[model samples]
Target: MTAVLNAKTVNYYPANAGWTNMWTAFDPVRINTDLAKAAALGADTVRVIVFPQTFGYPTPSATYTARLAQFIGLADTNGLDVKLTLFDWWSNYTDIDNSVIWALSVLHPYVDDPRVITVELKNEISPGDATAMAWARQLIPAIRATLPAMPLTLTVDGTSGAPGLTSLKSQLATTPPDYYDFHFYGPSERSLAEIRRAQAAVAPAPLVIGETGLSTVSTSEGEQGAYLARVYRAAQVAGIGSVAPWTFNDFAAGAIPANSSVSTQPAQYKYGLHRTDGTAKFAATVVNGAWTSATTPNSILNLGFEAPTANSPWRQYLPQAGAAAITTDLPRTGLQSARFTGTTRTGSGLPSLLTSPITPVQAGQSWHAEAFARGAAATGITELALSWFDINGAWISQHTSNRLPTGTTTWTLLTVDAVAPAGAAGVQLHLKSGDNTGTVWFDDVALT
Candidate 1:
């Protein structure tokens, strides 16, 4: 068996530049520094991406080609292998000749280079697109013809998962590459099962989890590390050939290209293991733990939400345009409080929120949860809920507390005391708002 390849996707855009400015603003110092960091984490390989349009397409410019070579050379200096992903931001599938010429131009220099461990033909190929599949099938053999010794592969995007790989395998069964790259972004608990399904999709051929990560935009830094710990352990147990996290560093605000859909979401920018300031996140420490066979420190669930890592993750649902946020207006004890504002509820439920999710529990064990909340111009009723979830992270049912004060109240106590129902493995301290116009502030939440 090949040694388990541990890699980090280093296709990160620095603070002010996006993919469009890659070559024009190529910073070798930044890239080299990041590569050294990855090596320090004990990763044997580092993945990089190349956008077709960014480099002059079918005909590459001398400067662009030189910059790419420089990147690989720097990786070699750091004693790390490279997985170069091509056709990053390209989609014109009609011109197969153009694709082949461009791929040939890109692979010519790295044909027999030892540092280039694998060449991923495309970033993520859509199985449903007939034109794209046709484009990929023809391009695979042409690349194999020139770079016979090199291992060639392609990744099915995380959105598609196993089903996408199954579809692609059915379409390109005859002319497949040496292996496959499966981008898995499913829940941590489902990692093993999902990987098994993906492996079965492309049986005889090997598979690697090319990308998996949880962004801190919606989760806490501690939870992000927990996610990596679980998934990487699952990968090791499943005996997959390789595994790599999605991003090495988070993108700064407005760093992603404005034209892409990712630019619209706030969560997309914070996926990196390193913050834009060059400091590492909790996930980076988890990477070190996994690579070195050391036990990762447990994630401290700071129910008070006051610690540096703030272990709880609070999310809003059925939100207004800008309904919910963490603010410093009136914190019960700490520097921050969660605010949820809404008009009237249109759906069956109120504009509610779920937070401090998934603490393990026994079947019939008694539990208590409490949070201090204040209402401003509040109406209707406020209820605290203990939402139960099964072992697979599936919601079962929720037990609501008796109604709290309805009208505007100062820092009132909301509580839920209940026994875990049968088949309950975990629970979330849920905060459900009123159905009518009002605003709520929550702080000092605890579940025990």
Candidate 2:
């Protein structure tokens, strides 16, 4: 009724688990503990996803169904209501008839459930895909007719922005769901603007920022807080009815399936307001700070490459197939720098070192990268760069900074500013030298 003041996405996955395996490997103890964490974060409602592969599609399995029920029960225990996100990581739009069967089969038990607050027909529906739209068209009214008392909504993926919501609202004009969900992965400085745009796209109907959060991939924990505060604060200022952040806890290393589309993405593991150890990040301090007093960002992670022994979050591209080591040979500001030797391979196979990923970047956001470097007769194309990735974790483009000074030079402060191209969700500071000979020394790299 009132503005949906406190909500969070329990993008729940335990250590070394993800959508592909979380359901089968569901742990009530882990979830019970985690949902309590959510409540402690000041969320009165939580959003969670159900994947078909693990949830038993077409006919929902008793095992995973009970698992889902237990999850809701745990939310209730935590004094929180639930918003169920359906068909996550599912793309089967061919069977409309069975889609109805699957939808009813899974939602039937929750028809009168008090803990269940909302239903998202599909997570990030593809507006451009006719088949998917047809599925939603039939499922939306079918579910609504059966569960008239409940609120129903679906969303366009962030890559589409507000225009995607406009397109979906146009296509599903006749049988639209109760409200619209908007997943935001945009410039935090423009968060309110983006929310306003989505509200305009889905006007006359209520709008919710279903998912928004900053990843610690590209920035420090403090930056993540500052960035995320901007989102929540803007949502409040924009009078958004509800706001569910992307996650509760960060994924542990190697937690995701290697075959998943997001495995290569470093940002995937770091969206959580809490760490895998159940410790809160600086972002946690301000997740609800937009509506409270704890708005100041506190960072404990080393953003600059100035950690003691050259390994905080910095890692080589492919260690088995790459080259790297800590070197005091050249210290910019700290006691060490990361030394990377160029590889014989070139192009996509080019070897280099990369900082952990930074995320939630939208088109035109300025990302500045700087590093001090000196080369040992470095041959070939040795350089520093800002690599960009789309919302789907696909590598979109890269902007190379000035090449590191070649042929035995002093540590030169190499810097460049990059504009995030259209649809970029993440960025990383990269130090590479494709087809390079000898070695390059780098230290004090920073990206923001």
Candidate 3:
């Protein structure tokens, strides 16, 4: 399998009213600037969704093909690998007909462009179950028959576990695609870890953390940086191939359609690497650091294998080596706390906690690894392991648990406060028990 690892792509949405809502590649100056800035940020790829409303619907087939060519021509000139998304009209209000796919078929030449790496069918299809697979089974092969060797990818809203990936796979008679993708919002670690497990349970196609980022209106930029570092580390260790964060720039007035709900939300203006006024956000620096340096100690870990169900709207590049660790400023607002009653499972086709994200504390950086641990019966838990992958891409294990005098429910919060291993860039926090059956509660893990 080929791993596309030249730094994940970033989204660029210009604030100018003219280019918003409509993506006209014919506008040379505007397209050039967007591509130039993306390449400057070490990005080798770019993703854009063609929603029905943005690009005319019930439009003439010939006209649609012409538009698709314009987009392809633009990407080729920009020297970027592209992940082109088709039929990205999210929400229930809009109506999309089969003509959209027919239009793509008519404009089939663009789908085969060298600059285009994968052609995504949709974005974040909810309840991505059998029905979705049936839809994909009908769609993917049809596209492949025309485009032959081009990779086809599907993106889901959340981790594969949310809607039961196993069942989705059972419904599909064909093997999963080249890669599976998903998104992670918050309780960031928990959501990421779940994605890793889901990948492991599925076959070994490359995995991708297709989308992740802190919401502009609700989270801090600093927290976003911290989460990006953590998530990247986890993804690397998990052997995930690649990751693409939410977007590259601040929102603009005409970025989306006039009636678009996203255009009305505050999050529409934020969730970018740069602020609305052409200013850079702190998270951008952290994301850049992780992307450019492969051996930079404390780098984010990428993780696992597993195919996403068909028709799902998320796709990501899986990390190599093992599972991935994803850190994000996006907070898990209302998700209830989870308590571990028994140890997690491990086996082929079964879930396993294979990777641990490490966040190294630097001299000036105020960072701590805090989590709750408990003991069962009267036996002390030994071999409690916490592994950290340093800047050099080497995995180092650290133990954070001591002997416990157990009996009742005893919770101990272990905090490690230290300077990031001199010149360290990232670290993962892990906890493993020897022979314990007690619940452990972990929350609000942060490094600022």
Candidate 4:
């Protein structure tokens, strides 16, 4: 039997403009630009929200249908598939027949189109609304009758463990979905465990992480990148069918409707991978980097700190009294390695230079890290450390390698064996110098 879903592809949620504004504005140029960006970021599929009222109730207008067709064509040209989510921002349980009309009008033309992967009946009907659930039970079968070959599903509002899922589960007994989809907005460790439980709970039906992300207000740009990398890695490791993050670009101040649900919340506008000015965020690098690694095994970018490009992934962190720089002298394996030379000690913490975040391994998974280092008349200890972070980019724990004695003229190898803790989501290789006078050269780092 053919598989019901494609587990190998990574999908994304693209909101070039805020949800309340995208459909009404319907600017083809903006939509195409966002779709192109999504494709560049390794997204094979994008989830789009279509409002019922805007499309015309009872039956959609011919102009709206043509607009949708144009949008789909644009997405296809960009090498991206579309998951059209119907009946967003609408709540009229008594008008179930109108919803069916809307679905048929929009989906009938795309029934045989390979670019249309799936259809979500409703955005997120409240679990407590028995009336809405009843309407859904009636509408799902009706839509299925009209488009029998199309894959169908519904999105639950909350996390896997939330009460809404319990209600959704009960409703699914009568109105079954081809895939069990849900939203998540929390730390990566919690999301990982929750996804597993959700998969078990909705057995047989494929599970997809429909929406997840961190807003800039709650985290820094670097942390946003780190968080996305961590959660995305967890989903890949767990074998999830797909993952669609919140958005593609931060909505400009005037893009949202004044009365819309997210209008008052500034954080919602900052969830985009790119700023409103069209500048790419650090998270974009993290996502694109993860995609490259997945397609090419053991393909670590900038492995030897050799990239001279601006916004290079490698970053250095030091206390008030420490300093670090990339040097070409005394190379370990490449033309250059990182060099640290400082005498003043802050006694705050271990001063070190760190690498770009790596996709995290599972808990209890054995991993090894290796680096070569040499100290020049140093009076302090030099060591290598591996640090772990949760999905929110919060530090979990760290493990340091055996310290190399100062004043070692010849290059020496430093290695550490570690197992990821229960909630680890991302890892960083660190070359640290103790609080004292020393000059350390580090290079040829590898982790596996």
Candidate 5:
């Protein structure tokens, strides 16, 4: 077999009980919610873990198998492929045969499933574990014999840098995998260069960065977003097979035991793209932006309001002297849409516009903003606005169009086009509503 992965991926690290409590009592609701969050982040693939002890070791339990199947089904429903890692955090070096039996028993069910992108033998097995390596050497062949077309991978800890990759290659010479999986948690440039070298050294075998992320300990939330954007861009340039960040949500306090191996690392707890309460961090925007840019190469971030969360970059402006509120309801497409409702005010706050962050634009270039909107008892005009900014963050000018007259209660596509100024550095899109005492709903807002 050949190595395979969805174009975009992220590690499905839970913000709740995490790996320690995952199998103690299976919670399908939590798993489904996490997968949905991942999907909302524009991830098409997720790296999941399945512990040996939880699966009944030598002979996998039927209950465990059923749950695993269901979990994969959930992921599939969210349009995600699974890179299932087996025997996570287990180091029973002497149980080599049992490990082989475990691999065979667990893998046979997913042998023909396309959703199972790859089956990892273990999670970050240490080079010092000669017994574990021996077990893997034997188990790989056994698994390959049974499922000849399955994509296989071995995740090696890359903390030691290039030397670690060399050591991993030497240790796994007996049964080389189709893909070389490694983890990196360093500067984007350094990680990029290291991945380039690793790819050269492990030619013919694709490389996947299984885990990489920045913690809020030393880096600010904004810096985390910038770092992820840089790393994602670098990975795209280097042609890496996939880049799965450390986690999806930050673990809550007391979620992990104080004595656990990962407890000492406070940074690990803050690595999630979302907080424990489901609020998104700035890193979510950067990741979503990078994924959208890489896959669609044209779509703007959060255009459809599909990622309905408070931390989104879309801003809702309320009238200074009148009542106004923004919400997600009655979407034109996807789960949610931006709805603005209130009494119209006069003066500077008469018409309010929901604006987007400054998006890079080129001078003399033409761009378009489109949205579907509906109005109920609205006596004011609803329109889309585009604003230009210079390189020094100075506002250049603005343009508005796609006006929907009052009393338009049906979904209507509103579009406007603008040419960037001579010194334009970026452009901002907005959903604007004229001073009216009614409700206006917007959805599927897109810019290109």
Candidate 6:
């Protein structure tokens, strides 16, 4: 049989070069140039920041909205999607103050725009503080009631305190946005695992890695880019919907005060894909490479990890291997299911499977299963058998079919039911490969 494409849309973040100038002064040429570049770079979405101070925060003036609309118009004209970042009160953004209502006033128009997919309320709200949450609550409702179109979101910094997985649940619960915006730095696989586990706490809600980079800003640009690619690809296999690196352009000398003391040299600008003079660094290349990847280093999909406690399991995937890492664990104990992985770990060779096993499901009881499978060397097909076993070890019935997609090193998610089964002690998910050499890696087995 032919290989299934398993092709998904990619969300890209390029440099919004003119965004800084928008704060105090709006430059048409600078803004247009940046937008044009983003469009040319194959980006489906561009994140735009609206600093409150420069745009007259807390006082809805027509001028601020007009200036923003001009940029939105440009984006629409270029056929690029927008992920409008609102109320960026970072250090340079201090003048914007913290008035979500004012943010709403200036941002509501774009939220209704067809080009926008989501509204990023705040950059990184201080952990344990409800500032971003408060803002989201006030804004989403107003926008939903007035001009509801795309989803509303707030990006969280570092899982709300290494407070671990459930740390941000409070914010999400208090004011539910459409997706969970999370960030990560460093190269620890354990931390990435924790981030994946924490995703369960906000089950059902989509998760996006808004920022990622080397923890230490002093690292060489080449090392930063390579590490960034590794982590970003890991994130993709681990089932993150989108991953946007910190910034696209290089940081200007002394442009940021906090880090100014860290590096005095001109080329030492930290956490950028490119240098100030538009020198594309190694990190930029890594991001570009990972953005288009469908597989990882280990290339095996093990579907035997913990299940997602979140309401939505389809939106998230458990941790797989890094772009260069590998694993072979499966979901063999809990949830009574098994997952199989293929060996062709790359963007081109992903293997897929389908299964049929009848199981009794109960109403109001949520049960979910997730798989991380790699693709085969070439295109092929497979059917899986999902069956229920009685205490006597006999097959009772079939649950799902046997037609799976095909790809290599790609981490794809297959979800059945979020509600638990009725009168069934255990369930099994078995895969039948289409060919002898078709290998797919699997991990992050979840059944809840």
How many residue pairs clash in all the candidates, one count each?
Answer: 0, 6, 73, 0, 0, 70
Regions more than 4 Å wrong, model 5: 1-6, 257-259, 295-448
Expressed as tens digits, the lDDT of each residue in 102-204 for candidate 5 is 8888888888889988888888887677787787788788899988888788877756555666677788887898887768776542344556666776666
lDDT of 1 at 71: 86
Which candidate gets the maximum TM-score versus the true structure?
4
Give a tens-digit lDDT track for model 6, residues 1-448.
0000111112222233333444445666765665665555444566777776667746856776787777678777776667777666543333233454676577666654667666766676654654544545566666666556557666656545235325555655755777766666633222344445546766677666666665225544434544554555556546665666666665554444343343465433456665566666655545555545533322112234332211111111111211212232422244423333332323422233322112222223454554544454524544333445442344566444334576554555554553323443334554434342444444454434
TM-score of each: 0.71, 0.66, 0.62, 0.73, 0.64, 0.55
**Candidate 6: segments with Cα more than 4 A from true spot:** 1-21, 90-101, 130-136, 159-165, 188-191, 215-217, 254-268, 293-448
lDDT at 355, model 1: 49
Write down the RMSD of candidate 2 (Cα, Å): 7.7
Question: Which model is ahead, 1 or 2, in terms of TM-score?
Answer: 1
Worst lDDT 10-window in candidate 4: 1-10
Return the candidate ranking by TM-score, descending: 4, 1, 2, 5, 3, 6
Predicted candidate 1 versus true structure: per-residue lDDT over 242-326, tens digit per residue: 6687677888876787888878989887878888888998778778777766443333344555556344444565675224566
Model 3 off-target regions past 4 Å?
A: 1-7, 16-20, 24-28, 56-67, 90-103, 128-132, 159-167, 295-448
lDDT string, candidate 2, 1-448, tens digits = 2323234444456654666666767787888888787777777787878877677778888988898888889889998888888888888888887777888888999999888888888889899999898888888888988889778888898779889999999999989888888899876645665777788999988888887877887766765665676666566667774666677778887677777878888888888878888888766766655434424222212444454331144446755445766767777776777776755663456667765332335678888877778788877666778887764467888988787656787788788788988876566667776566777777776666
lDDT of residue 75 for candidate 6: 72
The worst-scoring run of ten residues by lDDT in candidate 2 lies at: 294-303
Rank the candidate models, highest lDDT first: 1, 2, 5, 4, 3, 6
For model 2 the local lDDT of residue 188 reads: 67
Error of 1 at 43 (Å): 2.2
